[model samples]
Target: MIDTARPPSVDPHMSSALLLAAAVAFAAPADDLDLTPGAWPMFRGPNGVGVGADPLPADLIRPENLRWQVDVPGRGWGSPVVADGPEGPTVYVPTATPDGTQMDVLAYDLATGEERWVRKLFTVAEPDFTHPTNTYASCTPVATRDVVFVHFGKYGTAALDTKNGHTLWERRDFECDHFRGPASSPLLVQFDGLSPRLIVPFDGVGEDDQYVVALDAATGETLWRTGRDPEVQDVVPDLRKAYGTPVLAEVGDRTLVVTTGAIATDFLDPATGERVWRVKHGGMNSGSAPQVLQSPLGVASDAVLVTTGDAPTSLALLATDSDLTQTKGAAASDPALAWSSNAGAPKRATPLLLSLGQAVTVDDGGVASMVALGSDVDGDGGEVLSRVRLGDSYWSSPVRAGGTIFTFGKEGAATTLETGVFRGGADAPPELKVAHKSTLDEGVWATPALVGGGLVLRTEHTLRFYHPDGTNE
Candidate 1:
């Protein structure tokens, strides 16, 4: 629940007026820097589906395969985002001081691991306590050609010029009591007739404060603010907080904002903040973002895969056009509930959607499993196909390049799995095999980005770029 009675320090009216004044004299011309096949613009690339077209080297752990490595200034867990700029392609990452008082975003040259610029955005007088495994800068940024948007939970959200790293606009009035820390990254979406909007979620454990807000991308002006369902307020405060990110999905002819929260997954109209449909999974502390399943027939299924954080189960909810609701237990009776699984469901890492109509998930304990997504059109639930033990803890979600799946362990171990061929037919089970395994010097919690035929990764204290050979293309 958001504390509506507490007055914000910055008046919304004044903030809007200042933003309008600055836009007239100094706003960069918006360009078409939309998500491309080569750019990793957001948390899990396009549509939150973690797959890259470029093929990484079979063995990336060998020292000779390293392209370049650089020591980052501060600590952060947010993954690096890559975009093409006038000079060349640039990598943007967020970091902060150990005390969490100072936060900044660092830009580096994609070709060579050289620092381009650093923009310090916030200086908090008193900071809150973050989880031991989490950092002050856990929210990954979203980028375009002209501007990059970064969010630091309750501290603030700001937009910066991509070329020179200058501030375009900032907003600090949003309120939330993130007891552990903030990890939900913002989403950028543009409808056919609507302007580009940055959607930010504030699903903290505070009272009357769990809501989602959309801001005009050109300027930091609030367009709509929608609160969570009032029924969520009835749960315990800890059960109300969530750290999952949002993804955009096409349902029929309309686009919907599909997001996961404490007890439910919601589908909302992107143009308006109205709820279109919802499914209650009866779980808390959801950390994994929802993933849309694509059928083997080369079409999007009407079901989305979701996980209930800190719970033992994950679920698949059927997407519909009506404003109806269903529960996880209703799978036996309700057609809206497609399936549910308790084997190797992730608590932090988002599941990867495979091409063979199967979903792969790595639990926080380093257990990975493959589950079949039952026919979404027929309302059938699936079962766990296979399970494998990777032998190390994982917080970063896995990404696929070509036929190999990359899993990052918290202890700095990197493992690649070869998705064996389905010899029989398309419906045959997959033969999972471990391809290669290697270890790094430090722990890594940030997900790596694949771009320009190279992999960009962030560990505890440094950022490294790796390619097949020790040369930058």
Candidate 2:
């Protein structure tokens, strides 16, 4: 059980005006507060869905498309998040010193790729062992108009003013071993008439330590904490660790916080942090967040598509208005499972939902497949439409911009696939064509942010901005 007794340290530099603005922003209707063109609020953009409206060029490696490249001071695999500031759009990223003694959040001018501010939030005296491929700063930041929430797993979690990088409030007492390092990003949930909450998942290897905590967004006070069910905690310690992030799902008028853990995916009420339902799956060390599909399989209800960790399969849990629990362990006969497929299921990358009633998933080994979502709930859905081998490995999830899906490989390769049109029906499979393939000089583990009709990518050692017709001027 993590401690939340200590009060958050508030920065005096933050003014009341900014706090009031945050209140007003959260008070606005959800429709009016939809993600704008200038913001990439969370890990994979709004709700971690990894879809954007900007248009990215096919030839991203062309010199003419290189807007600006700046060398980042430290190392991290966290993706960059963008939000509108006073001057313009600013990019925020987290990084740690080579020795892991200092972890900081660096802000940059999105337009010119210039350094804006760097604020050190944590100093670890003795760092724990992390996987060679993972880092202490693997968690990305969530941004609002006025504040940006950053989490460094057990190191700390804080809210910073986006204007001047002032720490508004910080809570540093949450403890977790994070056996492989922290990768789950924080999620901000705001309702029409309820107080805003920042939900953080802590699925560690420690005994009886798997739980989710919600904090008051404005004050950094603990709102509620809910633990993973005891049945799911019976697994081995190594198998209990997870690096996945949580996503919000809208089921009719109710909003549920859907989180994927080692052996189970739990759905919780966003307001009370209480478990609404739990579905047990077969895999451990789950790293990919679940993707929600509305009117899934042409059904009137919504469904959640989840990837069992480190395995070659995925499961779809149909969302319903009633409370239901499925602990039968990834069986096809489970009443909660709408469908299950073993084709191109990702171990790291989150599956991308296409507009043509299809889902695209690229496994860590670079095999991308398109699965046709059938029209009815019968046995026809979850069929593999196509599969392509790209000959690369990926830790970063892919993002879709316009009609192109951009996949960033672990060894610096970028592949763009042009998704062709498909007529509505179960028989018509969508066409996927490789548009362009390019490799960078450095490795890329972080997912890029697509905003303002451009891209902000973080490589192993630097940050680079790209635009379709950008110049070095």
Candidate 3:
């Protein structure tokens, strides 16, 4: 559990409460577990901290240097997200049917490639519409030491024992149009001294006011439920739908919950569902993750970074709430907005806040560039890492480990670069690149899952693993 801030509200323009809770659960490939070391446990990983201790080879890994590939059952766009469980580090994979009807959750041993268990956690006779490029498993699963939770939107949510595939409990009554089927993944964090809390964001179809839910991870009990309305279910375009996930971070001793979706990026109280402050980015659709970085505490209590724009000029920066309450028109207008950068921002992929004040962005057309982090970036004068054409359009957020950043082409072409200051060791030579890479077939929209010194790459048809020492099995 993390100790939140103990300060009072500097501004009270919004409500104060952590609205979302956890949903859905998944299993990894059918294999003995051997997760990539220092891997991701949930979306954006534990506490939404993009910072990782991943021991990636300074050199890139190429596809021709084959490791081991395993065809996964069913199909999905969700990536193989991993977590350390009672069974050591295990991989939790959420899968969907080709027709997008049947959704399955499989847990695999991270070591030897073997199916630990595959449980049909939930099924929707009919599914909400998702992009053809999207998967019914768009949202990744959330897990703790005891159980893994999966959010299947229209199909409902389920919890499974990490040791075996036994479902500990499930709640299938939650309903959401998910506009394009749920893409916001579940987030886990310690709250009120209990087991880390489960936070889930639910965005229905058009004009539907989205809601955030909090749940007890062990018993599947509802703790709190907060939304954008007093209970408005209208389907206009007031900007209520969202595809982005919620994140938790403390500011000045207070536990502030930040959720970035379609219309608004709101800040709430982690202890309760109270809106402290909120800023409306006012976009029709948003598809990226929110990251909080070290910065001066004021408008946002911290610098909150997000990506927007099918074109450049679509990015913006705003603050999260310090207080939690829905009653607004209060004090502190617009909260705090450090700044927003529209320069070369990724339209589909979430931008990476890199080292040395630089942020790496990849456009929908596969144009990659490293831009400065300050909101006042001129976009004219700065070091341009690479302006070359890469893969087809991409949805996977680039991965940064140590001083190197890794972005995978939609076709599974992995590109690694050395960013700012070295967090692990001295910057490796530019000659060092992606040592190994491969693709199952189709483009991999699902982000790669890192755990236990192993990387699990998922395509629409198969899931593959790459271990250290250039050996994969």
Q: Judged by TM-score, which candidate is best?
A: 1
Clashes of each: 5, 0, 91
Q: What are the models' TM-scores?
A: 0.89, 0.87, 0.79
Q: Which pairs clash (backbone N, Cα, C closer than 3 Å) in model 2? A: none
Q: Which lDDT tens digits does candidate 2 get at residues 175-258?
A: 787888888888888766556778899888887558888877776667677778777567777877787889998765567889
lDDT of 1 by residue, 1-473 (tens): 12223322232334656545433222654444343222888897777788886877668756777888899887889988888865678899999987799999999989898888899889999999888778899999997767788998988888888888888778877788988888889899875566687888888898866788777777777766777888889988988988888998766566778888888888776666666677777777777778875445233445678887865456554544222213333333222655566666888898888877777888889888877776643444457777778988998998888877888899988888777554668767786667898998988898888877878899899998888867664
Cand. 1 TM to true fold = 0.89
Which structure is stronger by lDDT: 1 or 3? Answer: 1
- Whole-model alpha-carbon lDDT for candidate 3: 0.60
Please identify model 2 stretches exceeding 4 Å from their true place. 1-38, 296-300, 311-335, 375-378, 421-427
Task: Encode model 3's per-residue lDDT on 339-426: one tens digit a residue.
Answer: 5555566766776765444556777777667654443222222334434445566677777666656566677566665543333346
In model 1, which runs have C-alpha deviations exceeding 4 angstroms? Answer: 1-26, 29-38, 296-300, 319-335, 376-380, 421-428
Worst 10 residues of 1 by lDDT: 1-10
Error (Å) of candidate 1 at residue 380 is: 4.8
Which is the leading candidate under lDDT? 1
- Candidate 1 overall Cα lDDT vs. reference? 0.77
Residue 443 in model 3: shift from native, Å?
1.8
Better model by TM-score: candidate 1 vs candidate 2: 1
- Candidate 2 vs candidate 3: which has greater TM-score? 2
